[model samples]
Target: MAYKAHKLLEGYEKANSDNLPEVNIIALAHFIAKDSNFISPEISNIKAMRNGRESYGESAIGYVQLKREGHITTVISCVAPEHKVTSNGYKVEIVVDSSKGEITSCKCYSCIAALGGCKHQLALLGWMHRRFEDKTPTEKACYWKKSKLSNVGKTIKFILVKDLGSKSKEKRKNMCKKKNKLSSEIIQKRKPKRKIYKVKSKINVRKDPDGVSFLQEVIAHMDCKLKKGNVKVIPELAKIFLPVDKFDSIDIHSLMKDELCDEVAKSTSNQTDNPLWRRLRYLRITASNLYAVAHCNTVNGSLVDILHGAKLRETSAMARGTRLESQVLQIVSKKQKMIFERCGLLTCPEHPIFGASPDGINENFTVEIKCPTNYKSYFNFIDSSGKIKPQCKAQVQLQMHLSGRKKSLFCVASPEFENNRKVKILPVDYDENYIRAVMVKAEQFWKNTIGKFVLE
Candidate 1:
């Protein structure tokens, strides 16, 4: 199974490109086993040992230490329970294969399962599992509270101005004499020395790569539509990191477009004919893809599409639909006395991998405008009851989640509509359960697939 995301630790556990230790078998096992809900089948062996009276009470395991050495985990128990073989309590050391979740060795004298796990090792495992499951929500909250107080105590120690009480006058005078003597010795060593000679050195500096030259080459090689086969990249490097089998099929120009679009958005220049602006106006997800996100099993397809790295090229029909949406939004805003502001790319605050870019938004609601290209497209998006069809539900739900809004308004608009009656507005509420389901698929796609490659 791929790694599962923890919502509580989302912000704290960021990906480290330099050292991705989380994906290592041992580290991944430790993280999963720490969660209270994790249940391994090997735990049943511990229960069988307990039923046969092969171990002591649950409290026998004490001062346990767990350390990961390479792919193996070494567990040491400082205090162990006494058994029939020996009177005095024995110390135990258990070696575990973290990847396989099996005990490879034990140091206890009474153990018989040399090829397998013995009672002492199993008992320690049960103890650790129970310890995590035993913690209640209140206990966890109190633990954090005490941790904060302990930090505060350490921080406040430096502000103390005086001791609780004074000692004798002779003792104070002796302490002052020792402090003055130490201060004079320190001052003697702190004197500065004059330089006798100086040597000069010349340093070489390197200039950074300029993007304008690269952009010119890309533009010259690009197709007439400016979609794919525009830029060249190192295939072997991409293959070692990316999940795709064919690097040549992956559109490298799309990444350049993303960077250029970001530069255009952040720049203060007011020029309307910027090349980036011309490309950005036509690059957006199509209505057909939006429907798939809401109604179809297209998560895998979506991930593959992202890996392909193709830029969006708008056709004449797509341009007509975009213009229709804009015209309808303008007419609606004036008639209803409502304002709609354009939205930028938004990522979920808690889960950054999942992202959305809605059409527009207001204070109370998220706005998702869809302009159907034809009658078939319009009917496909509308249910029999004249409501916003279920096919586009997922898009608005994601929009609300990314925008942090409570509700969303899904609007279907076209230039042919004369009044509000021809247009449809459907209200969609936020659904956390649905969002979680989608995030699970997204997490697997990111961690197991995209995470395999290192971006340069």
Candidate 2:
């Protein structure tokens, strides 16, 4: 039946027909994953040839046969149009055998005897390759009219593409199930219930000033000497310094420092009037910089800023958050019977340069208060179980690691949302690995950078 249709096109477009290289089905399938360039003469040529062919007129032939793992067969009538033929053009057959890594049959009238191939045969191969390779479910269904079945042929020329779309839906459903199973395994491994406590605290630690005078005070205090020619490393004062080991010193100031910002900057890179590139180029990591070290790759900029004595800019957001933190502590203290001790920044005795300024602490648990300006930010700190988010988890864990407390309670107090202002205690456990990695960087920064600069 396939060869019978090819016979009709033997004399059609006879002048243009010539010997062409054979379409190797094996090489074509391999290229499908890495390239989509097989549609060489452009889609417009295919549509134009289909429309111009007077013999095939408006009749359509659609055959799609899909096999599991090793085989695929596609048969299409008028797969290659011959100019002004007496009957319907040729039918093309493409058969791919994965086991043999070859296309067993690639037949079309133009170059059937040549074994190599013709443009019509190649076009059919491209269509079949695309159909088997595309794995996205159909976004919308293709509708055809029953009364005008033959007329619908023009629009529904590539039936294999639509068939693959429907097939892909089944493939995707199975994939999603496998993904869920893997995710379940991961969650089970990390499943430790969080402990909660409704402790009341009235203590409020005010936000310290960030100015030249404060910097002078911190440096002067570090100048305090012991009798044995040893310098006192005050953990309380260490919070004011930027820990260098927290962030990449080289890439920190580059144009692509922030991934989100990098994407935005790239789209606007061609704009001559944009000042973003210029501004970003000169931006420096400073002591007064307020950023999330727990959520990002690097530590805060305080260490770098202090070493170079960069000018500090006071931010209203930091001041507001700090003030709100104190207010939250006050409410917690009043509601609960427990008292939270007011404290300064505490550093590890071994790594004095690494400091943690926990909002409040008691004998049983340490406190880390968050005052999110918005509801989204507020909810980001806690999950459905009131456990801290993984990003914020590191922060509280570090606080516990430094304060010598096993349990750390994180409280979110958002004043803008009346229902969210209450201090909900979400106790986080200590992460020794995280603290150890941070301490190593802190040690390196202190000994190599800060030690040399300060000692000199």
Candidate 3:
């Protein structure tokens, strides 16, 4: 039999009357809690319930319909808040045996977990339960109206004071023009006018009166006397001043120092084998994991554990890459005729929590070497045609950014190829927009996940 998509049932009367079918609210709660259809982690279940309640409150559930055939009652509704602008929503259908006080069948349409159950299904169940709990005899309000979530995408150009029932523009202008006499008097007294005066000199002096002699006297006063010797000199002055000719002859290169030389001096030395390298990258989101952090949907338990001091065991593939990294770098350097210097943990100055450690870096570009463990993986890298995998691309971009280089070399190596074709080097230019997006995700993860866990 061909599988057909489920559609909503028609001809059922809308559930708007005060008198509605009796539903076991407690049973519904028990189903959500223990039923295999809705089984999930406790935290996920809690989040689902919260989300369902929010959906119900936001009026995401449309007009519910109730139909009866013998002792079985069928309830149908649509959950519409999933999309911001679309009128279409997940259709939820529940079949209950009213005589047995149990839900025999429940399913939701357009949901991946429809056969079992999903948050949307649970939301409809919750909405029905809440409706049943209301003991008032008043007529139930119609829920056929559009959900509030649909309005989320709406744009408001501007808001006026009249829209908020505030004073009008004319009233405001009139109020600004009206001045109290007492207030005006107080303002005048608070600000006093500046007074102008004319003066005449009583004594006459020469235009130039021994200026050089006065300067000499000032300099002489600044001079200090030695305790035991008859020598006068300025305090804290250099003991010996070299002549210009002698200074010129001295080595200026020896005196000039590079400030960053000290900071990155040990950078190339901290590799995976070093304990300091792991410690430095322990709580930081490095370039390699930026893609995962950005595209993560739920609490990434593995990543979270790793962030919380859990050691990541190197896989066979990773070990292979590590072993071949140096060989790949050598091949690349030999072919490209460029000195590729190894780099260690390089952190962003503006965002300290984010870091990167490129395989190699030089004056022109940073390098990232990948040695695939299998031929299939190697071919996949090759098939990319210079536009590498998104994760690898993000890693290269971040490495370039962290190393302060405008370009990067993505090198791929495989043993099966000939020596001349052993390694492939692709040039990748720095992408500011992509880097900014990655930084935003990194910051969110650092603050929300890592920061929260540390606080706990």
**Index of the highest-TM-score prediction:** 3
User: Model 2 over residues 216-301: C-alpha lDDT tens digits?
Assistant: 23233223332233533233233223443353232211211133332333433332233332222111221112123222333335
Residue range 114-218, candidate 1, lDDT tens digits: 224345554544444443334223432111111111222244333122321123468678999989977975785487633421111100111112222212222
| Runs off by more than 4 Å, candidate 2 | 1-303, 306-312, 334-336, 383-387, 415-420, 445-452
The per-model lDDT (C-alpha) reads 0.45, 0.44, 0.60
* Model 2: worst 10 consecutive residues (lDDT sum): 198-207
lDDT of 2: 0.44
TM-score of 3: 0.42
lDDT for model 1 comes to 0.45
Residue range 207-323, candidate 3, lDDT tens digits: 112222211221122222233334422211111111112222323222212333224336435477665456556556788888887776556478766554455545445777887
Q: Which of candidates 1 and 3 is the stronger one according to lDDT? A: 3
Clashes within 3 Å, all models in order: 1, 13, 0
In order of appearance, the predictions have TM-scores of 0.36, 0.35, 0.42
What lDDT does candidate 1 reach at residue 449? 37
Q: Score candidate 3 by lDDT.
A: 0.60
